[model samples]
Target chain A: MNDPNFQNDDLLDIHNLKTYFFTREGVVRAVDGVDFKVKVGEIFGLVGESGCGKSVTSLSILRLVNPPGRVVDGSILFQGRNLLELTDAEMRQVRGNRISMIFQQPLPSLDPIRPIGDQIVEALLVHKKMDQRQAWKHAVDLLNLVGIPDASRRSHSYPFELSGGMAQRAMIAIALSCEPELLIADEPTTALDVTIQAQILELLCDLRSRLGMAIILITHDLGVVAEMADWVSVMYAGRVVEEASVNSLFEEPLHPYTRGLIESIPVLDQDRKRLNAIPGVVCDCINMPAGCKFAPRCKVQIEKNMTICNKHEPHLLEVSPNHKVRCWLYEEFSH
Target chain B: MRHTQCNDGQSNLKESTNHILVEIHNLVKYFPVRSGLFQKITAYVKAVDGVSFNIKDGETLGLVGESGCGKTTVGRSILRLTRATSGEILYDGKDILKAKSSDLKSFRRNMQIIFQDPYSSLDPRLQIGESVGLPLYVHGMKNAKQRQEIVVAMLEKVGLKAQHLNHYPYEFSGGQLQRIGIARALTLNPKFIVCDEPVSALDVSIQAQILNLLSDLQEEFGLTYLFIAHNLSVVKHFSDRVAVMYLGKIIELADRDEIYKNHLHPYTQALMSAIPHPNPHRNRQKRIILTGDVPSPLNPPAGCHFHTRCPVVMDVCNQGEPEFKEMSPGHWVACWKVS
Candidate 1:
């Protein structure tokens, strides 16, 4: 089943991807020219605030964007093939079988009436050549793999019957049924409590190592990203503002937005009373600024008298090894 | 009211009073869950069961817990926003629940609440100025010109411009809207404020701004706060003392340092450990991953509420409920193993 020609370790390569929402007010540039690579068995974090297009970028990869929103430009190269070029049927074949996704709210996403086992078995039946009996048995095994105690009995319970944590575990079981190469977990732990969130993150980490599957963990919490992701691409107003290893991202954030976000989080370990918050809010996608989306709110840009920041949007410029920042302040560092 | 963020020594120097401003004794709130053909009240969701704590004047007391843990219920009960099932809520030596209707109106003027979702809390139809000045109108402020002036001044205190008075809730960002919420709370110049997850709805960039504003307001006005939030770090950062709640009960109550560093309760330990550390290297260590979901509060475990999922559960934990006791100086815990 392995394709030798599937290129380098980049399991998913998104290049200049643009997904826009055609609303009555204006064109909402949700995921504007987003570029990133998810390597084999790598945990790639997409970090951003709400409406910054982290979810849209993920949705675009799976071709899940509705008519109101469309993946207008660029390509999603998954397994050496441009996913955008694939037919609907071909894409469907690749979807659950190769790349499965688990959402934030597990109970709502799962069918209310059907037993979780039937739901999971349905996924297996649709993706694989398995009878109901075999699929049900396999579903229980998958549930067990996802750390659900009394898998067989629990599998027969409906979504409402299970608690939030257990429902999340059930969702993970369904996601892992086909054993996809890339698992897109979009805020999988956001709806959960702290303890439950930790469990889910641990499961994600454990499953990644055991199955050697690349993961795209989309989350707003930098702490969650820091704890789990090996590398991260910080998105601001529908653009990847910076890319760096998890350590560097936390230690020395190059982008002003990234720096502000990191500093903004309430300090856990230190005795710091005051937090250094960024001024202003997230840029609007519809009535976007002429230049850098963050320029108006960019303190460093104004401090440095970088008027160019307001005139032209800065492209992703590689400064350090394996680190890239999209800002006018770091222009001198770029080649 | 139009004072700038007094970050220069004055804000840091908290002139906190030692005497309790709010004394909640054995507070309990249970929501009725109806069922069957006749829709009879078959059970009760014990949202806040046997919770007790105190908030000192001009001091921020953080109440933290997971979802449905009754932290919010506790906050609401103190202000008499939601009627408690039992227990006494003493505000400045006067019981709030026993206060007459006419007296409670004045009591509400001294006590205000700022909700979580800044978007929904403020009316979208009303102008920002009207929303801010609404409380003044209700409290028998007659002059429109005077109300306008007060609203403008209050808005300025919260880092909003005089121009923003004309704009609606939709026009402002979540942070600015939250500022409006804070400004509204301060209009009556309340002595106490219940900040219910004020920054949870805002982005990380904006959360700090709101927190800074809240702290500044607290300092400038000498306002007491009962800060209720699900995020432990936010609570730790903002509060002087903290109370950790679990399944409608205050399992642990201590100073911020003690709660963060030397947490006594097993549930508290797990909750603390569950927080994803900002540093990648640190979170890889032993995180006390508790198994199973939080049991329904409608029919909590016969013994300890947390015994169902407690990692180090003993026979006593399952047999009888442990009494909440002060094990250390100002540190209270409700676990049999801790003592």
Candidate 2:
């Protein structure tokens, strides 16, 4: 079951991770019981639509959950050690050294007043314990590695001086400066143009191959998951509804939600009047349902037979050798 | 007025004439830069410099470019949301750019616009019903009850409920707010719409719902649209014809299939090459990584605006500006090397 390429040489093993935001109305369960393992040289995709708790999950891994939100349950094991159990001091040591994350929006993520090169150097010196002279050189090298031309001169330029694409490239350089074992990229290409998006993805892919780093790519883009992910976890309302290999998930999506998402993508070849969009909006997390999270918007399921789906919550059941689904359809067939 | 694109002079032309609904002739919108205590106009940001295209009666024309490419300006200028410096905006053979207040108001009823961010577009204080019915109130169409009914109907059309009409912008999701925005634009029964990155702010799953709704609404209403966005995948699906703009000018405009299949312009080619296909197995060509940023609109290149980034840049590109000419029957491109 374990191929060298998709090895379980656990770099990051998240177990029953839950992040909930405490609001006056109710507790918004952002990421509930998401369990996944990232190997040393594999790409794991945490994909879902907006408000599906993908970004929250990434933030949780870094121990950066804000005031309203807290990690209510579960363990984040990095290199066989539990990160949740670690003190703030130890967690800081692990943050940029063991795990680094690149934000979706590069403009705001960067220091506006400071030069981008200085940002990279600061991250390097603070995390890697490098000297000022050595860190500056490393920062310029990192910028060059990210395909930024005139790296030395451009490094001196402020964040505002660089274009949108350049700012993104600079952010990538900063994220990869420490050469962390695990890199968490949250919608890295979301704000970029198509060409620039492709370039950034290619660069990430190239870096992954070169460094042999484990990556947890969080995005709403199914196409990106298809291209880069070895294993896919489709999140819906703070829970992984379906988890499978990229091929299996694409070829035969067991979860109705997964199928709807795939069908909704507008193909260049198809000359259709309208796309097969999944009707209804995503369920509000503040007032989440008791049963299956997707039960309210589910179109194909028979309401009468959806008693279990509406009343009782379903756990991830192994339907195939590797494929697992949280839907009631798999439960009846598996039994 | 109905079919002006099909010129009678061309003997090779087989398709019927009068398919064009909106024809722009040398459309230029330059924003003056005021400086100093005297407020002297030093320079101008040529936002939409000599940009032109034709939108068919019922087909959505996708206008795509980077952030500063003047795509949204073209849309605003068409609807007369922003006054153009100079150029002709022909709508049904009448110059709408020079239209009087009454005539412009009539033109506004025929053409509407949907903004990018629904939250900012909609007033948080006003309820959805009031926002949607504001156009009707402005036009003096019906009484409050009648306006409410129309708002409800429009809300239903965008896949929303009448019960939610009393809710404000903050009460709804990004997708829901966008639907409200669409409802607001359509309340006046406009024949044409400028959807300025309508679904860019929504989630991927919600994006599908909005796109599907737009397609359905377009079919039902027989509405023409100018879909402006940076997302190439959405553009490919939504538009019948696509135009690639750069530095305030269109470099390439062609039929959907033709552009995707056999792209001619360097910028269009680079843009198309950049879109990552769903299937990773298919080996894509090396991306034409354009060096340097988009040139400032205030000081564009002397000749070809794209010359700085063009992979196959020539001496002629730096010498003089290339003439925008029709390369094929339905395909038009502006490049020194094309002719």
Candidate 3:
């Protein structure tokens, strides 16, 4: 699967990664047979609706899937080293030092009782052996870098005292305190209003250029993915149904699910009488169907006599140089 | 169904060029903030402060604003779900605010509301059928068998099966639950409905489904909607006219095309540019990112509430609030700069 010319450029690569929750009711395959790669300094968008396993895939990378949920199979290669094979101590060192994550809601992720400044300082102190005074100064600088006004004064305030945008800025400050190589932001601006959301998105793009860090942005909003991501992966059920550059994906989506998703969004400029919404809900994970997960909702499959779609699971095969899709419609095009 | 009689009475109501279903004039709703052990009234939150607009018959009026901007408060206040502090709410030429309890009870049948959070809005204890049919039973639909038949028909109208009637709320998905919510709102054959962020909580695909269903139902029933949402795109698609709200105030109100094409208010412009375009090829617009959070309604800025963050703030803007006046045929803006 490795191309010799572009091998080292890939920062994080996953091969058939599977994360499942073993509950008494049934084994829920959250992230099943997922595969994708993020290049250095590129923004890779992981998008899908709720319960589609986009979040689970990110948690699996950090080895942060809690008990009852486990990474059952597949390898997560980060910087050519398999993360799934790492020891707990090594993984801990890799967490804030190399790859940091920001959550959807920043308030609950932060400590309510502690000052926001102290939280950043604590992250710095734990990861690096630095003096308290120097660490505190660096924390203030980080806060200011994230565009927080009156950083020094605002730092002393508790998480509850800060607004939604301010709290998210604090979260970003903590994530960037270590100057990590990769930042995994899970719906970073979903809680924010549009104005603040744009501000946050701009700040992230600025930080990426200044710090030269790769980003894995996970969101359900396709508009956000289109604006920010260099490459996009459309997830369904628990697997990546399609992967392509942002331009190509939006211009001409190959996978049925990706096409439906893009068509489903209500565009701001266009006065579309009716949005072409995909019928039916996502597949049930515990009792998932045999073949293509999206077959039930695929209008293409229903139109053409694509009986193979239901009988056999399709692999993510390349149709173009950079575009890959997991659908039988492109089977003949795959080279 | 027995409720069909109510529609006959509504149809007799005069329909003319100046036919307005509901008109809100200088509505004010304030919740007092208590303090200390004595629980004295410290100040009022002023959730809905002096806002006025009219919903034309069989037209969808979009009420849009950022969170905590009193959009939801306006919808609730118009329904009298939360008693207004002051101002007149005229429903078909009758002041609902001045209506007696008996009158208000009957008027509620004509006006209904669909809440944002489908999960919390519904009662988990009751069956889905009972939940949808509760309004019918309360508003004098006696005969259990007749109510059940109407409930089944209503559920079918919202794209649910009759078998779903016996199921509990927990048994349905978020999209399905929203459909049930819409079913409940439509069961009364309401002439006007306040869809308060109805599609905000659902997924994108499901949101489109719900929006389509709403449009279809609107055409079928000749319903007037006050569609309240934070997402501008959805509102633009569904509403004939849109009103932009700031902290407890309507900063701009215009026809859908006028608001989108000739947005005059700075706040509205900022909001328009902030929407992330789904197409990547389009050159990104110069976004006006408003700095600072919305001020607390308790001690709101003295003059214009938006002056604190407006890019083109003037001395007069800080000293006095601008009057919301019609600049064009249908466009109304509350900004000194626009004039």
TM-scores for chain A over all candidates: 0.98, 0.95, 0.97
Give the per-residue lDDT digits (tens) of candidate 1, residues A1-335: 44578768888899999999999998999999999999999999999999999999998999999989999999999988899999999999888889999999999999999999999999899999899899999999999999999998998999998989889999988888899999999999998889889988999999999999999999999989999999999999999999999988888888988888888888668887788989887777789999999998888887888889889999899988889999888888865
Residue pairs in collision within model 1: none
Runs of candidate 3 with Cα error greater than 4 angstroms are A1-7, B2-17
The C-alpha lDDT values of all candidates are 0.90, 0.86, 0.92
Residue A75 shift from truth in candidate 1, angstroms = 1.4
Chain B TM-score, candidates in order: 0.95, 0.93, 0.96
Worst 10 residues of 2 chain B by lDDT: B1-10
Model 3, B1-339: lDDT tens per residue? 455675565555424425899999999999999999999999999888899999888889999999999999899988888899999999999999999989997899989999899999899999999999999999998888888999999999999999998999999989999999999998888899999999999999899999999999887777889999999998999999999999999999999989999999999999998888888877255667788888988889988899999999998998988999999998999998987
Candidate 2 collision pairs: B2-B18, B3-B18
Instruction: Please give the lDDT score at residue A134 for candidate 2.
Output: 95
Q: How would you order the candidates by lDDT, starting with the best?
A: 3, 1, 2
Measured by lDDT, the strongest candidate is 3
The order by descending TM-score is 3, 1, 2
Q: Candidate 3: lDDT of A40?
A: 91
Q: DockQ score for model 1, please? A: 0.80
For candidate 2, the docking band is medium
TM-score of each: 0.96, 0.93, 0.97
What interface RMSD does every candidate have? 1.0, 2.1, 1.0
Which digits, one per residue and each the tens of the lDDT, describe model 1 over residues B257-278? 9988999899989988899988
Candidate 3 per-residue lDDT over residues A36-95, each given as its tens digit: 988899999999999999999999999999989999999988888889998899899899
Model 3: colliding residue pairs: none
